[model samples]
Target: MTPPATPTSQGRPDKPALTVLYDGACPLCRREIGVYRRLDALAPGATVCYADISDAAVPVPPGATRDHLLARFHVQDRDGVLLSGAQAFLALWRHLPGWRWLALLGRVPGAVWVMERSYRLFLRVRPRLQRWAARLD
Candidate 1:
């Protein structure tokens, strides 16, 4: 079945509310997006577009692949600007009221480096974590 159309603020159905392309196969990535989806649902006037790129129908951009997405979060803001990894997380955080402080953390000394490093470590262990999750399933 086809998905319902995403509604727009100005009554235009042609544009996406907010595009969040994610890696569906990775458990950690899925969990992270799950949080975003829940937050979006609670926020008023929030229009989120969620797409899992593991589907064959999803078209990946240049220099981007399933592996790349598996390594980092990807989000396209309302204006079509693309952000990945820590920047993407920051973008999403900025939308939530209480979590806006996390966006400020992005500018602190060594914070971006730490976030990037932690994300890299997560990417490195994700495959093994997926295997464990599959076993549990």
Candidate 2:
């Protein structure tokens, strides 16, 4: 499928919006997404959007199942490039004000590997955090 042509922040009408799918039920996820949403509002030209993957009815693109989304973070770039885990986070940071530097830094050698390892470590305790979040919410 041809990617729809869209205007970039530079006013070139060929960039696609960055679409991020995240777990709303996860407290940490909610907090971070909330911050990014607020940041997105400040820069309307950036065209970053989000979807809550925690909802069973949320429609994702073909080839991505609930299990797949639940397993890691997902970000579909303007070119329809799908990224997961640390890459997903980097995709998101690239659009948000004050985060572009970190995103750029992530592209450095071994940064992604370190982030992915950290992400995996976080996943190890995600369930417990989710339960705690449930009680707090």
Candidate 3:
């Protein structure tokens, strides 16, 4: 992952930047991450780094692989807590400027369940989505 331009604020280096681990091999995931990259660029200090796990240049944690990341999003917070799937998305939303409300909603009773189910449905159809995206490329 390329280091983003240096943060303008001189803060503690111990503050971990938001690390988003995504599937590089999936076209649909790539398109979504591209949008995130653009948004992060607009909000400079918003992200520490982003990694496409499918990239040979990117390092994966022990026992992790491209297929694992393709199944869901993974986010590692500043304190080194790892969140997956819907929980990961919620964590990310919490960090975004105005989307903190979505994060709160995600934690509401049954919200995580709904998001997880929806994510599963998306995964089920992702192969077809990838093919469709590829045709456009």
Scanning candidate 2 in windows of ten residues, the lowest lDDT window is 1-10
What C-alpha lDDT do the candidate models reach, one value each?
0.73, 0.81, 0.73
Cα error, residue 71 of model 1, in Å, equals 3.5
In candidate 3, what are the lDDT values of residues 1-137, reduced to their tens digit?
Answer: 22333434665344446678888787788887787677666664566467777787776655566567657889776656667889988877776666678889975899999999998898788889889998887
- Winner by TM-score: 2
TM accuracy, model 1? 0.78
Question: What are the candidates' C-alpha RMSDs?
Answer: 3.6, 3.4, 3.1
lDDT of 1 by residue, 15-42 (tens): 4445678888766667767888888878
Which candidate wins on lDDT? Answer: 2
**Runs in model 3 with CA error above 4 Å?**
1-12
Name every residue pair that clashes in candidate 2: none
Query: Between the candidate structures 2 and 3, which one is better when assessed by TM-score?
Result: 2
lDDT of 2 by residue, 54-128 (tens): 888777767778778877888888777788999989888888898889999796999999999999999999898
Q: Residue 81 in candidate 3 has what lDDT?
A: 66
Q: Tell me each candidate's TM-score.
A: 0.78, 0.83, 0.80
